[model samples]
Target: MSRKSETSGDRRPAQADALTLTGRQAARVAKRRRVMMLGLRGIPNVQGGVEKHVEMLSSRLTGHGWEVEVVGRRRYLPVSGPHLWNGVRVSPLWAPRMMALEAIIHTFLGICFAAMRRPDVLHIHAVGPALLVPLARLMRLNVVVTHHGYDYDRQKWGAFAKKMLRTGERMGMRLAHGRIAISREIAETMGERYRVPVAFVPNGVAVSHCDVETGVLGEFGLTRRRYILLAARLVPEKRQIDLIKAYAKLGNTGFNLVLAGGAEFESAYEDEVRALASRVPGVVLTGFQTGDRLAELFANAALFVLPSSHEGMPIALLEAMAHGLPVLASDIVANRQLDLPAGDYFPLGDIDALASAISEKTATSLDEQEVLAQTERVESAYSWSSVALKTLDVYRAVTK
Candidate 1:
């Protein structure tokens, strides 16, 4: 009788232990559904491709039953911005506002903060911040690195900075549990060089839902479909000077060439661009614009040109395409992947070719059918919902 009683007591404890173990397992599953995003400066009206990407992806992830926390830089985010935007938690970490050191320093601090949060996946964006992937991995965090572009190839980086970027690429490829390349071209390039399989997840564009504010157009003295638009950061690799020169060559084209991007950092290139723009007759520098202002600009443009020397799937070009605007992009490998018609692609650095193409495109009437087809293609292939699902797949793969 004593043996039977003892056995019953043992079974009771065993049953309790089983229930406790089940609860712990369930908690782990819950934790695995949470993510920590890093590397982008900040979000919500920020003038950056990566920030836009993070904002869209994070907002969409939550709807699919994933909890997301984005680490933002205090300097970049507005003072009035809330701790939460669209259900994604925002944690701002203080960092110096210097150009070269900001990303690395902020990413280091972000990784430390993420470690404490114990998110299932630590998703790092851009190669600059991927420098600390090894460190994050060492902390036993599941790391997923997204390669935005070949930063080392940018004209602004010095030799040491270039080397650091290359090193970061190496470390990120080797250390991270998974990798995402924003374009097929980027994915193929990285895979060939590093011998690591990467998931190709291109950047997405949202169809503008805002009404075209004609008042904003009047504020800039612009007419509907009578202006050429190039909206991107006023940086060297974007080659705004090249566009300025091309526009200057096409004097009296009747279409005002508008450069609608803000200076990224104080530099000789920006000074040179402004100097060139000053010399040009028809070129307009509208600085940085967003929201309805930017949408109206895109909606009513005669033609959109992206003559960047380099790109990782240019978001500005995608935005123009999303708006059903006729796009003329340089024949850079990334841009070529868009499969624009032969007429739409001008040879890189060919000022005469760009000027001529601009003149020709402006004079010719846009094929509404072609524009509709392009918009359909862009929306179908590069929807944020699709990007979010693919990114979530990467996160789940890494965590599992």
Candidate 2:
């Protein structure tokens, strides 16, 4: 007896069914693969510390098999380009240019997009955008927030804005599925106040050994090791004007005073800083140098000074340490976390003390051993690879 031959028609249906099932599984995997980032102006050479942090973290996450997408402000990012860069995708959404409205508006739009798209994770950076954490939860989205600093403490914000920031901080810490604080101080502050468990993930830096490019020095009329560098945005809290006044009081020590950042919505403050800096001979205002120029400034400066009255974790200070420059910073809790030598810190808001520290530190060069120690500490404590790994662990914990 001959058995009925199996027909191609029956085989074709089974094969098609198997292919369809496989396609659905693959699509599900892809859908589960993405992490959506928000609350930065943009990445890939954007200005703010939050932008830089996201740029490094998001790019590194992609190498670990994450499809990272950052929601950026349209005005900050270029209008025309492929959305994907390297492995991270950038979605530039529109927002007004006004400083007060920019972050909130952009973040609202970003959160809505993440909700509609249904990304596996929605990661928001900084307390300003964390205001929407409750809303994100209501949308049934998994949320993670990184508190860069207490923005309410910043001098630029008005009373209402400051109150809103405080509310955001409270809600974000209480509501997010996972939370990251950038410094020990921040972690402690949040834990003590909000009673929430938070992870401490400090910022990272790229350690390099390039020689100080003399061309940049010449352009700014700076001599190697003859300048004191203060690189931060011109804002009242940063105390750039304090640095200028201190330098002016010191009366033209052969060393130049270099201020290496542009204005950040503080036109009046910027104008005051400029006028003060202009009055002092050898005070160079090199508005916002990045890449090689910034590196050169760090490498060649006699000393790096950050007199900020408030901070989360100062990336400027870390960059200086990476460059192996001697550093003097204000005695704030955030700066204190650096574990710097006691001699390296001046009383906060003390112009005379800052001037004295600058004079003493600049006159006395850092010992070779001290410089090596600083570089070693930076390498051990703040490498991007290590930071990325820790952050990924947080992501995995929340996702699971």
Candidate 3:
């Protein structure tokens, strides 16, 4: 019930002495919770996967009796001090970028902030933030760098930018005290390419938040009768256009296609997708819908599809399943390991096959028992409390 807001924050230099819970310790007794500073693109649900992950994780961890902090961009917050939110200590640090590219600025502030206020453990979510490893090591802080994905896979990074990200990833993994990979695919990539041992912890979802309603279909010439959901950024690897072309081949105008999520970069790719939509019917673009709105779009759908070429445990697909919409995702290793039915699997980048699969599943709906089974599985496996515990284990291993 009582609190201290560091509004400021992680170095893995030393581990704190573990404390035991006493019956008379007062149920509300605020013990010494680890000072954890999580690295993210931004915080407090800033319209991205990392932000959403942190927001949900903070609430669940705090509920589990951990003093949580949700730090994010300073520009979004009114005050420049540490503020408390839902029982977590949140320190939002801000700095002006002084470079042609924002990566240098992002990396600089992450390291500088971690250096100033050393946390019991530092969990860096963004690859850009992983560049802080040396600084964290210098501070003797236990660093747990999470490899989000191959950031340089394809976006608009020059040769130098790509090299820096790859080099940074390689170096950060080696320098950090512990490593966390969101998916086994990424973990293996780390070991094979970077030679770092990583713990696999997939992203979590809020089941309660899965309940949703949406007008995306009506707004974009789609009918509620039936449709497929493909929520992802309009980037190359996401392969949204591939879905568009495949939908054209299947030519299921009765069942519309809803493409949520905005363009990260690669404006050309987005423009191309839009152009294809102009020629093709039944393709609706709902730009960046999240929270309840995102839930509604997935909830009302006949089937959800993710035609991505690469992924590191996409929460989007998990959210779709939570909505009880049987998924028809790319047959990537990540999707395969999700332990879903074989009927849900589809070939990656094969538009005709993906579209045909969507049409075949449009008439089928998940049974109530199956929905409950999937929902319960997601709740236990990817719950924030569970994720936080796994994360703490990694921290404990490093500090010990």
Give the range of the ten consecutive residues with the poorest summed lDDT in model 1: 12-21
Writing each residue's lDDT as its tens digit, candidate 3 over 208-284 gives 45443456445666555378888887777788888888888876457878888886444677888889988888788
Candidate number with the higher lDDT (1 or 3): 1
| Reference-based TM-score of each model | 0.91, 0.91, 0.82
Q: What lDDT would candidate 3 get against the real structure?
A: 0.71
In candidate 2, position 56 carries an lDDT of 85
Give candidate 1 regions above 4 Å deviation: 1-32, 80-82, 212-214
Per-residue lDDT tens digits for candidate 1, residues 180-227, read 999998898889989998999999988665664548678778888999
Can you give the lDDT of residue 163 in candidate 1? 98
Q: Which ten contiguous residues of candidate 3 have the minimum total lDDT? A: 10-19
Give the Cα error of residue 198 in candidate 3, in Å: 2.2
Per-residue lDDT for 373 in model 3? 90
Instruction: Judging by lDDT against the true structure, name the best candidate.
Output: 1
Q: Which residue pairs clash in candidate 2? A: none
Q: Identify the superior model by lDDT, candidate 2 or candidate 3.
A: 2
What residue pairs are clashing in model 1? none
- At residue 400, candidate 3 shows an lDDT of 70
lDDT of 1 at 259: 93
Candidate 2's displacement at residue 119, Å, is 1.7
